[model samples]
Target: MVELKSPAEVEAMARAGAVVAEALTAVAGLAEPGRTTADLDRVAADVLAAHGATSPFLNYHPRWASSPFPAVLCVSVNDAVVHGIPTDEVLADGDLVSVDFGAVLDGWCGDAARSFIVGTPRPADADLIAATDRALFAGITAVKPGNTLGDIGFAIAASVRRDGYGLLADHGGHGIGRTMHEAPHVPNEGRRGKGMKLRPGLVIAIEPMLIGDGTEDYVHDPDGWTLRTASGARAAHSEHTVAVTDDGARLLTL
Candidate 1:
């Protein structure tokens, strides 16, 4: 069921979102060649600890997973799309990295992700990251009272298509509140005006994942968590938690 958050609950969620944003910023700053993905996870854990927030990703076991998540950060590199576990793998120059994180503070949750290039960036990789970032904002802009969930997905899909990128249809956004993942699944591609109607107090995470090779097929890693593009094409992801309000969309994870 879709639960509309009260004003007080929304305020709590905003606090959690702030922690998530700060941790992601700090982690992103450390993304460089020669740094290990596990190193990034350590930084994220410190940030959350300093803020008195708990990691929502750590030890999280969804039905599909064989075991609980082992790290605070989802560190996807190169062809990896999402759910990438932190490993000792060293980041290399021109590698495209995507980090997804979630934090819980005062019983509320916030989730977000960002993709960028480490060290010397290739032109195509930079463009791929830029496109996903733009798509995230486009979807966030579509969040407002009376707008359908399809509207959000349509806006995001249009942005990706305009850049000639492929959308990861299997993985998309979701409603977020007391829990990390909630009701009303938000796909990256859909027909406008075809899904649930948006309303005030409805908070959601709008994320867009795009592939460089224009393919949606992906494969799972031996870890039973990491997802990578089957065609070995690089991918990028961007996300932000937003709330639909009477005025407009309020970005909780800004």
Candidate 2:
């Protein structure tokens, strides 16, 4: 069932979102060439711990998975779309790194992700990251009382498609609160005035994943967690946790 949060409940989720934002900020700064995904994972774990929060991804075993998640973050390198696992693989120059993370604080959850260039980036790669980032914010802007989920999705799709990138098909954002993933599957592309109407106390994660130059199709890696582009093109993802309020959309995962 789709659940709308109370104002006080929204405040709790905001606190969790703050921890998620800080964790992402710290990990992003440390994500340079030569750092392994595991290294960044540790950074996020420590940051969440300091805030008295724990990783929602750790030991999380959603249906369709055989084992619990063993890492604090999803680290997808170039050509990888989402759900990338942390490994011994070291980041190299000019690589595109996508970090997806979540935190549980006082029983609420916050989830967000971003992709960035490691070193001196290629013009195309840099452009993709920029577009994806803008798309995420554009989607968030559409989250407000009375708006439909389609408004958010259409905004993101229009922003990225204008630049010629393809949206990932299989995965999208979701409602997040006491649980990691909840009702309201927020897609990256949809028609405005469609889907569920937004109301005060509704919190959702708005993310957009764009492929550099390929179809929307994606395939999971052999590890059972990592998702990569089917055509081997680079991908970028960006997200933020937002709450619909009587005033407007407030970003919790800033």
Candidate 3:
């Protein structure tokens, strides 16, 4: 069942979201040519620790996974779409880096992801990341009272598909509360004006994963989690946790 949050709960969630946003901003500043993905993960963990917040992704074992996740953050580089595990891999010029991080404060959770270019510009890489960022905002605009889940999905899909990017089918956004993932799974593609109706006090993470030059298929690496594009084309992901209020949508994860 979908649980509507109280004003107090939303306030606490906003606190959690602030930590997540600050963490992402810190990590983004640390991303540059020659930095290892693991180094970026360390930066995020240290920031969260300084804020007295805990990472929700650490050792998290979802039902589909064979084992618990072992990283504080997801560092997907280039062809990897989402759930990319941090490793000793070093960043190179023109590589597209996608960082997915989540933080929990006082049992409340906030999740977000961002894609960035390491050094010099690759036209395709820049364009792909920009498109995913736009798609994320398009999905966020649909989060309001009375709008169906499909409305959110359709807005996301329409934007990315128009740019000729592939919408990821295996992974999508979900309802987030005390836990990382919850009910009302939000897909990247759907028919508008359909599915569950949005209501006040509902919080959901709307993420868009767009593949620049591939199909919908993804391959899991040996690390047991990182998913990469099947066609080796670059991928980008952007996300934000948002809450529907009496007025409109308020971004919890800024």
Q: Which candidate's TM-score is highest?
A: 1
Please write out the lDDT profile of model 3 over residues 125-187, one tens digit for every residue: 999999999999999888889888899999999999888898876678999999988887988
Residue-level lDDT tens digits of model 1 in 1-254: 99999888899999999999998999989989899999999999999999889998999999999999999999999999999999899999989999999999988999999998899999999999999999999998898888899999899999999999999758889999989999989988888998999999999999999999889889999999999999999999999999889997999998
lDDT (Cα atoms) of all candidates against the true structure: 0.93, 0.91, 0.90
Model 2 ranges with Cα > 4 A deviation: none
- At residue 58, candidate 2 shows an lDDT of 93
- TM-score pick, better of 1 and 3: 1
Global fold similarity of model 2 (TM-score): 0.97
Candidates in descending lDDT order: 1, 2, 3
| Deviation of model 2 at 36, angstroms | 0.9
* Model 1 residue pairs with clashes: none
Clashing pairs for predicted structure model 2, backbone only: none
TM-score per prediction, in order, is 0.98, 0.97, 0.98
lDDT (Cα, 0-100) at 230 in candidate 3: 88
Candidate 1 lDDT trough over 10 residues, lowest sum:
167-176
- Give the Å error, residue 9, model 2: 1.3
